[model samples]
Each structure stands twice: as C-alpha cells, then as structure tokens.
Target: MHLRKLIPFIGLVGLCCACVFAQQPAATGLVDAARGRVAIPDPTKPPPLTNSVNDDQRRPRNYDMQPPTIPHRVDGYQIDKNFNKCMDCHARDKSAFTLAVPVSPTHYIDRDGKALQQISTRRYFCLQCHFAQEPVQPIVGNGFENVDALAKKAADASQAGKK
Candidate 1:
C-alpha cells in the first residue's frame, strides 16, 4: 500500500536528517546546531569530508605527487638512534648506498645557521611529518594520471635511445 512506501520514505528522511546534524560531544554538553538537537553519529559510516588517511599513516607534504612508499615498518625502530632508521637511507653518506634521497640538508640546520649532528628532537618523530607513501587512487569519478612518472619514463627512454 502507499502507506508502506510512506513508512520507508519517512524513515529515510529521518536518517538523512540524523546524519546532517550529528555533533560530537566535548567536555561541554551536547553540541547543537540551529535546527534541532543533533543526532548521534553512526560509527558504521565511512569518514566524512576532510578525512583522509590518519596523519600517522600519511606521507610528508611539500613533495611532488606520488612519492614512493616507505618499504620498512618503523613500529619500534630505535628513535634514539638519531631517527636512525630514516637517517640510514636518508643521510649524506648512506643515501647513495640505500638508493634513497637523504633528508634535505635544511633539515639538519637548526634555527641557527649551524648544522646539528643529529636530527632535532622537533623532527625526530618521522611519522609526525612524513609517512609511508600510498598509491594514488582518484578521489573523484574522473581518471587522472601522474605527469611526473610519465616524464621520468620519457627521460629514461631518451637516455636509452642515445646509447
């Protein structure tokens, strides 16, 4: 009957409204919007907008798109070892051997001009700023390709052609 259809339609409207206004509780009382008391958030829902991977799981910023992912797990590496795991691959001496780019020399310089022997404690937590890279999956419906990877391949091809 039409009444049955109306029941589902009414339920869907309520569900939508619930999602649209839900506010998290803080030390203060229930967060509320102008329209009504906000409904509870559903944990089953995928994260809402502005939610990307956790900051801990994500890579550093200010780099070109699609940097390679970190290969080793950093779970309990001796951070006291001068952020040593990261430094091993990303240091002035070992970068060439590890085939990894060293941390920028700027990272070694303190706010003062002097280069410190170790990574500053401020930069010691690798996950704080940098993260293992992730493969690029388009967030929207459109297909996109990374130009940098293509450019690198073209350069390699040109070099091979010359030889």
Candidate 2:
C-alpha cells in the first residue's frame, strides 16, 4: 500500500536527521601533534632535504647484532631487481680491489640454514637493514642506552652493593 512506501520514506528522513544531529563539532585546539601547529586544512611546507653523511668512516655499533650503517652517501645508486650498485664495491671478490668492506659471509646463507655461493635473495636488499646518517637534529630526543653501557652500570651497582 501507499502507507508502506510512506513509512520507509519517513524512516529514511529520520535516519538522515539523526546522523546530521549526532555529529559533534571538532574541539578547539584539537590539532595533530605530529603536524606541529599546522592547521588540519592548511598544507605544510616540507623541510629541505639534508645531505647524507659521506665521510666513509665506519661508526661503532650501539649493540650486539646491530647491522653496520652505510658510511658513504648512496644518492642515485641503482638498486632495482636487475642491478645492485652496492655489490660492485662490497661483494666478496670486489671488496679487495675497491677497498670497501665486503658484505658479510652470513649474507650468503639461505633462510633454510644452507649456504649459497652468492648473497641470498632474502639479504640482497641493503637499505632494508642499514641506513646512512645525516647531520640533522632528531625530531624527538633519544635516551637509548646501549647494551654494553647498561651491563657496565649493572656491574658497578653490584660491586657497590657487595662493599
């Protein structure tokens, strides 16, 4: 009947009205902290790109099992499926002539615990595990203590307690 059609139309309008009234206005000063005072609607200017560290001097690892960081800048280096520019200098045979540290022997091992003659497919991507540094202040402060420093502190505290 016409009444059944009118009932659905009335229910749709009620639902529309409920949805419109249910929305609360965004709270004042509820800005995103990550955007750093940038308004939600306004576009933010990106910071200038900083140069990567290119000194080539190796930095000490912060903890055990930490991957060594890239010492030189790798801008524009091709790292596609067809080519890996890093292998030119860092491959086992090439390292001797290039004076670049060779990729670790572990890189040649497969995920199944078997050794391969070349770098394993799983470990071929260098950037996934290592990063180059830039001379820029971190956005947030780091208070990370290395494993050695924490161990030394624990040793010192135990020595004092035994006294």
Residue 126 error, candidate 2, Å: 1.1
TM-score of 1: 0.40
What are the lDDT figures for the candidates, one per model? 0.59, 0.85
TM-score to true structure, per model: 0.40, 0.74
Clashes of 1: 1
lDDT by residue (21-114, candidate 1, tens digit) is 5433543454443313434443333333442343444344333643345544555556565346777677768878987667766667777678
Q: Which ten residues in a row are the worst by lDDT in model 1?
A: 43-52
Number of backbone collisions per candidate: 1, 0
User: In lDDT terms, how accurate is model 1?
Assistant: 0.59
- Candidate 2 lDDT over 60-156, as tens digits, reads 9998789999889998889888999989889999988999999988999999989999889988988999888987777766899998899999999
- Point to the candidate with the largest TM-score: 2
